[model samples]
Target chain A: MPEGYLRQSPLASLGLAARAATAADAAGVTMGERERVMLVNLRGDGVDRGFLDRVRQALEVDLPAEPNTAAEGTRHRVLWLGPNEWLVVAGEGEQLAAALDAALAGLHVSVTDISDARAVIALSGAQARDVLAKGCPLDLHPRSFGPMRCAQSRLAKVAVLIDQRDDAPSYDLYVLRSQARYLWRWLDDAAREYAVRIIRP
Target chain B: MLLITCPFCGPRDESEFACGGEAHIVRPADPAALTDAQWADYLFMRKNVKGVHFERWMHSHGCRRWFNAARDTVTHQFLAFYKMGEQAPDIAPVSYTARPAPRTDPALPADPALHTDREGAR
Candidate 1:
């Protein structure tokens, strides 16, 4: 186990395991948490080839050049937050932040380990899109948003980063730690009509 | 719902954006040398145009970047969106031919039901 602080999931008190077992009989929506994952915020000039080359050498994947897109690597996934900023989601035990700091040593860039600032909630299954579309105004159709695509938008009136994980149509919502509970309750209420399963992180 | 296009992130809902008031207002280089009236003018005065207003907007919930946009206040039609430090697009003076003028003609008859001759109707 890692530190005790990192061991506790944000939704620990929600009794999600029991709820998930009850809803397992149906197959509408499956919700889970990916707690204590490493989240690093990286910022550098996208136009600078040198910076891009350094990041690619470090992570073995080119930082996504397009807006609202994500690039997945063997051990890490980079989501584009802005033209010059990205969020690096890596395994909890990885030292990707130190590696990035060394790789971008001389460059005018930023690599901050904001691992605990946000909470990740996974929403999947058939009606996941319907549950999201109920609040988010983005065009979540397959053509507009698919696997590896990411967007920063409001869900249930709270700011969230929506990252589409795969064609299973799964999504990982990165919400501020302070508002994670509110977002969870909102999602639970919204997904009540569907077969809602809450899984452990 | 107004769909404002962020320069970096395509079009997004208006709820994701926050307007930063009128755009292209340069601050004076020498604030200490200016009179109170001049300083107040620069601080308080703003153009409230009826159409084709230039304004600054930030995609607060999205990219968190600021950009400029030209929009028609009357129609709420966004004319163009440009990144910061770029020149605002030059649009031809547009005329509003479809919008009707407010009815102020005295020749039009008033509704009789709206008027009553009964006293103490106050």
Candidate 2:
């Protein structure tokens, strides 16, 4: 309980800064940690217009109703986890959950701040898809999984939620906090063949 | 690997799914009134059929939603995928009765040479 305590990511002990500095400049894959992103689990009646409208008003973007899709607002990215379940990734802490709670005051919905439950690792570069293809069974072809698409699937045998951030084919792998180190190591080793640059956030 | 089509997430590898045994087993309203045998029958009895089987499957790795599927046990072919609480689709069941009939021929001895009476052997 120190007065000036610092928040550390699960992969903090990996010394990513030291590694990134010495990484080959011509690497095929660049990996980094998005340690400050906040996550919130939102579940409500997807069929209810009122519920949907309230959520849209709160987030300033429509929650993706289609499976495996994501909608990005100015501050949040809403990923559809199921028919009525979504995971909101926000750049700020706790405020998104508060906004959702205020918007859905009397509705039959659940909004939980799950920011500490998972860790997000950013992966992108020319050979990123090939590195993911080594273990994941999902069709990662751009035609199938373009930007703004997200999916919950296994990556290197670890359950992860993959969000394709852009046409650079960048992805954010959301892994359980307990398995973040293991998944990071797996990705590190998997990306070695393609030359990985471990970027620090 | 079998490609299972989740009603919500579409086709995914079988590894991403977990099979929840036989579907549509209703729970009794009053369990206390039922006899022990009746209770056990309701709890343990499962129709492990060989033909068109309706089962519950969860898209564990994908959407993590439970859905129903009609699959042929003999052929490992999925007949249909419907959402949970929905009735099984009415499709002409796959050919499950294609098992070859037992070898029967009048020309063959009633008991093949392999079956020898113990007394005859003595």
Candidate 3:
């Protein structure tokens, strides 16, 4: 095997970027283009302390120390997914997987780039929670999950990470890429109660 | 409802956790030297004690971390919770301890996402 080959994740081929949009629309209205981001799975026989440190050094971002909490920057954000897992999101066109893999190779960890493994759905509107309430049981009220708050919970039968960020009741739902169409249909059906326009990115 | 005391998150509904069965079972030093029956016993058998017992539970829906809990099997009451690698509290032993009857139906709500098999499924 080539010396640097193993250090690169295959998902690096897909560029990742953060998509931001305005939510000036009405109730249940969907504004802003949906953007896709990479979701990487990090695992090892044990916690790799040095690997985490190296990742912070390379990315110039602090890893989220609390579960369900997210750390964001101008171009990237890292969410604490689990004890040995994290979700790294960056702007589209960025080779994040390979960059992260190469940055933490000596730490005895396995990084599987999941850019294509998951789907990203961004919802912003007054009725965002109203739509989510149809499937999710968690309290989506702004007081419970305001900006920077995240939780790994169910969106109907599908597992998802729900991040509530915008004051306009906007939310970002993430699930396996294979379930994209299913979730989209569910969302569309749920949003029908209110006026919603699907914006393409 | 079964209210589990998370070592880190305080008391949370049992729905947030996954039971890891009985804890404190040490592995044999040389597994290769054991007989088939011995290996099978170690791998598949458990006491499933009815009284106070130590068990492992993962806060799958909360911190997404594993910890230990001292629970009364009969009452389904958690006596204490401890993080992984931490020692269980030292409780005095009582000779007259009685096994509490298992609660036939617990009121805890289910957390569907914690049981899903997807990546970052917690």
Clashing pairs in 1: none
TM-score of chain A of each: 0.93, 0.94, 0.79
Clashes of each: 0, 0, 8
Error of 3 at A44 (Å): 7.8
Angstrom error of the Cα, residue B109, model 3: value is 28
Candidate whose lDDT is highest: 1
Model 2: pairs clashing at backbone N, Cα or C within 3 Å: none
Instruction: Give the DockQ (C-alpha) for candidate 1.
Output: 0.80
Model 2: lDDT equals 0.89
Pairs clashing within candidate 3? A15-A93, A16-A91, A16-A92, A17-A90, A17-A91, A17-A92, A18-A91, B74-B100
- What TM-score applies to chain A of candidate 1? 0.93
lDDT for model 3: 0.70
Per-prediction DockQ scores? 0.80, 0.68, 0.20
Taken over the whole model, the C-alpha lDDT of each candidate is: 0.90, 0.89, 0.70
Tell me the tens digit of each residue's lDDT in model 2 across A127-181.
9999999989898999899898999999888899999989877999999989999
Best by DockQ: 1
* Candidates sorted by lDDT, best first: 1, 2, 3
Please list the residue runs of candidate 1 whose C-alpha ends up more than 4 Å from where it truly belongs after superposition.
A1-7, A22-24, B95-122
**Candidate 2: regions farther than 4 A off:** A1-6, A22-24, B92-122
